[model samples]
Target: MKTDTVITKPLLEIDKSIDALVKQIELLSFVNPTNIEEEKARFFSSKYLTQPVFKYPDINFDRFKLHRKLFKQQIELIEDERIKNLYEDIIYTYSGLIKCIETIGSGKKFYYNSLHCFGTPTEIDVENAKYILHFEDEDLDSQAFAPKYNAKEAESFFRAYSEQYDFTYHIKHSDKISAIAMVSNNAKTLVLNTNHVYSDNEIAVLTNHEIGVHMVTTMNGLLHPLKIFSHGFPNNEETQEGLAVFAEYMSNNLTVTRLKELAYRVIAVNSLSKGYSFSKTFRLLHNQYDLEKEAAYYITVRAHRGGGFTKDYLYLTGLKKVYDYYHANKNLSLLLTGKVSLEYADDIESLIEKGLAVPAKHITDAYAENSNTNKTVDFILKNLK
Candidate 1:
């Protein structure tokens, strides 16, 4: 360890305890209730083929409840009032994540709990997706980026992207998830779906959004004196994902097709609260919305995967909120301090003043002034109602 580490008194002690507490709060690795691809493949190969009914991975509910109680107890033991409030928010967020995990395998109740956690898409949100549905972009309609690259080739691209920032991480191939980037136990892993072929937009978006923001913040969190910085703040998903999507926009790779995909996700999530079935949601996107059948299948699976995960709707919601924040001339650097939320900008500032946090070691590349390439996408983002 470096000698320059500013080991403040009780704050450092609090940080150590919070860091240890977060070990049991692993969300990204086990967020999905089931391995969706296997279910789909099994359904396709059956003699009597049928719609896939997903079975979630078994989580230790009893063990998690114990962890929850411990986290609550930890929050109560903190001495400083401001520090205590910060931890109170952190513990609250982690507790919500725990509830999401516990409720995953359950059906409509899961949807109800999810809505309680990540709010349901509003009437305007549904209309925004509908408006995006009718948008006809001849350029995006062409499907210019062919799916030709294999897993090894894609891995090379990801490695090259990481190399640009002196980032050290591992790349793994699996058919389990489309593509997910995670930071766990001081190790970083990026998993790719080897079964699906890649396109330029798909590759570029992941490069900027996942690597540029998510990984950047992950590394920055390690630099903090507080462990809560690493675990994330309450409602961090909306801002974190918003920042990731904003990175896509800043890098000049965000497309109408991609934005429409996010819109479709909001629509799919909206269908869940309305009690739409798997086939019903798929038909709503394919027949009614006129999405490609292949695209429709994935969207339905994502929204319906854990019986009713409403989290997908937040991608669009986050994008809008982040966009508005940026346009308002708010400080994006505060968000980059760690896996943080816009709601706690003041808390972060306070930490910096008291030597509990430091400036971001690796500044987000997307935050640099942009070239402003796509006007239409910019216009829509600007006018998102």
Candidate 2:
């Protein structure tokens, strides 16, 4: 609406069609195993020797038909070459994701597909994880480390946090989520783990990480004329996860324990590339790394679920990139303008200029002030390879 050039009806129609198709393909909806609690109990009962068989949500949509429909779109009708290239990449990305979802629980087939979508952690990433693991954890006596709140209390906390923004989102409790908390973008819902307990600092972390950034972008994406903003750009996961974790850092809620957990994720993910099985990865984290059995099991589940999910490693890598970007005094708000990638900042600006996109409606509150006081955590982040 800001541009003088007339928007083409064909482009709008194509965009709308693509949006509708892509909305049905949210990877998180199917990526998480449906029987996590059952599998967890089984794995624990076996004393960490058994390889748990995880069951995933059924893919309701026809993948082949969806694929056909996606490619059927006449993207060539868009006059702008840059926009055309973006759409082309988006189609391929979504196509790859469909393959990932389709092959879930198919062992190495799913792992290879996952590798194609989200690459495995590199040698440097492993080193970074090892580096973080070398640091001593904070005092256990600290109130920030205590798990004193239940899922119901977390819902209340999230509800209160939601009051700060002019947006409405649902909060639901589930036992299926890998992480303790996550934001489902398409549904505009924040899903919390029903069985997990929350610490005060973790509540703050989730509020800013999930709602402040994830939900904020979810709403902001809906405001865009271009629905791709709402669905996501190609390889938007790293940037989105980076921004979410960075919000924790900015809010002063990021603890060394949390950073170590992310590091453990990198280690866990790296194990997959080495052909480690679920039990093997669990041993690597629990026996060699000295992580608690429950903690290690969950981390192992995150990596081994959906057959070698390497996406968890992105958090540390993304945090490093975003941290460097922030130190360089870059415009953080631009990156917050929906489920966007940092690499596409210029493209987003172009979209805004062409009246295809708009600026972020809600900025992350954590970005407003440098409230972080942990100099040790700062040193570790600054030194990450």
Candidate 3:
């Protein structure tokens, strides 16, 4: 063996640090099991109330204000874009934290509605050149997300979408959609758990917002030079969700009632986070907000049902930020370039023509051509002026 054999490993210490930082960033993507358990105990523990009460804690008042201060300091010290991106990530992360904390502490629920049968089709009986339509209802006896829908139809939907987008991978259809984006053994494909909790209006709003923007960005990012694009940009969910809700507004699908509903949800979820029972929150929205019991119940269930699911508050707050960006005429073409809403359909359409955000690769065909959708579209198109 040669005495002076050359070493192959890189000699850069900064590279090692960079690698370590990248690892830390990746770890931030998924929830930690220990932290999840601690959060669960904090919510479920009977001693939560008696232990201590936070009286307008500084942490509670401004979730990310401190984080922003810290970020500014870090940015001053760092020159690398990766490290800078980390600060941006932290800011977005803290925003969700603030909303969750506020939502949990609000002590109001029961305004959340668990509306059923949102995305599924309505049956029509035609007579004398007139079509009579009926919205379907969920069957309590069935454990399906929708009434009598099959995976075959789900396969068709995704397949058709794939063909339009000129790409195909794996897809799994499901009767149940676990909102948790975790390790699900059910199947490897994107699941469509379309039991109708949202309305036709809500469906259009979510479709553009969720599938159109969120899912579309997901797929388009996959086609990028970096595989991470598919994974989503850093701080993706906040941007994605905020953008999605904004799309609905751009398309003029976002209603005042929906906005107010999100506000109520923020209050409801915050109540649950602060240890209020479902009944108490339900009563709060019902009594204070003048929401009916059924409406209040849905809001409460969404907030309190899963015991500390304080994530719904982002809808309204996100909508506000997105709308503000739109009003300012920001580089929303980037916002529109993904599968997104026409929140400001006209503004978005301009970008689409320029090949920024692509047009929808898929529209729910079952409803797209229907009289109901046509009427809704017509109303929206007319009002756009």
TM-score of 1: 0.89
- Candidate 1, residue 30: the lDDT equals 54
Query: Which candidate do you rate higher for lDDT, 2 or 3?
Result: 2
* Worst ten in a row by lDDT for model 2: 1-10
- What does the lDDT read for residue 176 in candidate 3? 32
Model 1 C-alpha lDDT per residue in residues 100-135, reported as the tens digit of each score: 667776787677767776788999998887776666
* Candidate 3 stretches greater than 4 Å from native: 1-164, 169-189, 194-203, 224-235, 286-298, 336-385
Clashes of 2: 0
TM-score of each: 0.89, 0.97, 0.47
Highest TM-score, which number? Answer: 2
Model 3 alpha-carbon miss at residue 257, Å: 3.6
**Alpha-carbon lDDT of model 2:** 0.89
Q: How does residue 44 of candidate 3 score in lDDT?
A: 37
Per-residue accuracy of model 2 over 1-385 as CA lDDT, tens digit each: 5644444566778889988888888888998988888988888888888999888998899999989999998989888899888989988988999999899889999899988988988999999999999999876447776898889888999999888899998889998888899999999999999889999888999999999999999999999888989999987899999999999999988878999999999999999888998999999999999999989988998999998898999999889999999999989988888999999989999998888888998999899998998887898999998
Ranking by lDDT: 2, 1, 3
Clashing pairs counted in every model: 0, 0, 34
- Checking candidate 2 for backbone clashes, the offending pairs are none
